[model samples]
Target: MMMAVGVAERTGLLETAVKATIARAPARLLPYVVAFVACQGHVMSDIAILVIPPLAALAFKAAGRNPVAGLVGAFACVCAGYSAGFTVGALDALYAGITEKVAAALPMGQEAPTHLLVNYFFTASASVVLALIGGFLTARVLEPRLPEPTGDGSSGDEESPTTEISKEQRRGLLLSAAAVGVYTAVVLVVWLLPGSPLRGEGGALIPSPVLSGIVPLLFGAFVIAGVVYGVAARTVTHKNDVPKMMGESITSMSGYIVLILVIAQFIAVFNWSNVGTLLAVKCAALLESAGLTGFLALVLFVLVVTLLNMLISSGSALWSLMAPVFVPTFMLIGMSPALTLAAFRIADSATQMITPLNPYLFLSLALMRRYEPGAQLGTLMSRLAIYVVPFLVAWLAVLGIFYAFDLPLGPGAGIEMP
Candidate 1:
């Protein structure tokens, strides 16, 4: 239905509409082996978020000469979407342990906003670095050498510049720039600018200057930018069309929304059950008896978190279960909870994109198949590894060095937050 509508909208063809509707074809059409392999339940992250990636990828796919740009663009969108941090999605779980530990009783869960900078500054920066490197590798290395048409939507031999495509690029870039600029400025004020609105009342304000604002800022930015870009890109033309595009975006997101809602509820329920707090307490107590140095302890904590990620896909759940223990425990060791959490986060995040259990990975693979049908999990992983590997190492190194120096992750954000 979606592919069909998109094809009709693009080609203005009615007869081909029925055939065009199915892109990769539904799971029912997959070969028995593929279906069996895909059923492993590894992909558990909230998938509704995929809407953002495709929206961002739409222009790139239309304008780029190769699959590399399109893939990078999609990842960019995913990172930005992750920046939102609401929806009790994968990210929320990751930071919940730290966030709630730092600032108790988070009124903001999935529906409300959280400060993205305080909790997610490191993640955001890592995301940008990864995106740039991925884009470069795609454009310079893969685009020029990629093989002929093979994927579901692969049109290697039939490339052409369309006015619509040009228009979308112009619109998307403009909207993306404006949105990112606004978001950056907000972070600057809260973290860099003195007397920023969110600056805590005084010293006791637990990482006073930098409050939780980045995620909401990002969410607002992307939602607005997506709408504006849709109109400016002519993907949507009329004022009325704006609503329709949003409607279309939301309509396409029913499945993901449902999943995230459950995820959110599960998070709240898990917290209410006090399971997370108990687990954190027990772990922290056990670790305390070890007498490791602050840095060594943090390093081990991060490794543990990374391994935990393989078993549990929910970042929020994991965090909720970890922060109470790690943060206070680290604080006792003369380390900041924020820093401790940040270190763990760096380790936890770099593996998500590569994990087989991540549902979004499958979506990415599906999209990749559109450009190269024969592209399998291993092939995509190999291609992604080149950039992702560098990113992981660079990011972890920067984070470790940053925490060791007791640098602020952002304004009012600091090495220590009781």
Candidate 2:
């Protein structure tokens, strides 16, 4: 995540492209463009919130539209899309690693080898669902409700500069795209070729090197793409600039890294004490006794995670705490580990928009106040709740349908355990 963002920032790939796209979009489509930008939070919520909202505000202003609802709507989309991205990235790696580690501690843990793409299908689909819903609400519901902007069109910040895509930037973007294409081809060849190294023994795809080594693959692809873009874009004039950007990115993430370490230790302690497993067993037994062993229990579990998300804003941190208990519990009751993760992701993401503790929420408020000088936190929260309520209800329905139909959460990852 840090690596990709650092490169994007240095090369101006994300911001410049987004501004250019929005600039070209029809006035009536501006809201949907903002929604699309916000849905990109699936890639990096922290980055999306910081970069997209301000640009969206600028777009709204240029289109002679009120920025209030659009800005808030973009924030809402980012929060909702945080759990699902178009492609697998660091968050997928982190969550899957945690799930695997926790699952390994269970009695039947060895039967369920965690794969990087465990929730890929569901999450990728979820990205579309969120984008569509957010765009619809922004266009049909929220925007209509917002009052006209009264003050000067300034967003309290200095006006955004005209962001014309430079020839060099275009070349850089194209070259970066080429690099990614080549890298993806190589990966596919390595995985799809019979007797390839990435394939498991006897060429099995599951439990293969591709799944287990996906994190490094992700890192390599992003770093390679970033470097190519940076050099082409002149962001990296010297070789040392690469390491400097990486260092700065990592340094900026010191707080999050520290949090992950603390949470990792807590997970370790919990697992060592056998508390999570025992609790899972008891919970599963209790649910079974109450005739809530399947879809109903899954729905209840999601609601519990949603409540937990209000207090704990970090998805990975919360998953570290919850997966150990919930994954095993779900698996014990005939649900798959992948299905449990899918439900947790839906709940965690849907509630992010409403969580006061979410750092992004405060950041979003600050951004909103830039447009509406009088924007109060409480008022914004109340307005945002309008979006959150429907988003949650719709998402829960999606989850329910997914559960009831016994959908595949990902490739070879069905809702039922063996």
Best by TM-score: 2
> How much is the lDDT of residue 305 in candidate 1?
81
What TM-score, to 2 decimals, does candidate 2 have? 0.92
Off by over 4 Å in 2: 152-163
lDDT of 2: 0.77
Q: Which clashing pairs does model 2 show?
A: none
lDDT of 2 at 174: 82
lDDT per residue as tens, model 1, 1-418: 2222222223222111111221222322212111111111111133323432332233334433453344533453242223322122234433543454333422222222224345455554554454454445555655456565444354356552221325454545556558657876776655655555555565234444344543454445444545555555555556665446446645665774676566556556646776645655566566667767556777687778877877776565566555545654555445555566667655565556666877777777776676667778887666545544554565566666667787666444566543
Q: What's the lDDT for all of these models? A: 0.48, 0.77
Distance from true location, Cα of 124 in model 2, Å = 0.8
State in Å the error of residue 277, model 2: 1.5
Q: lDDT at 152 for candidate 2?
A: 52
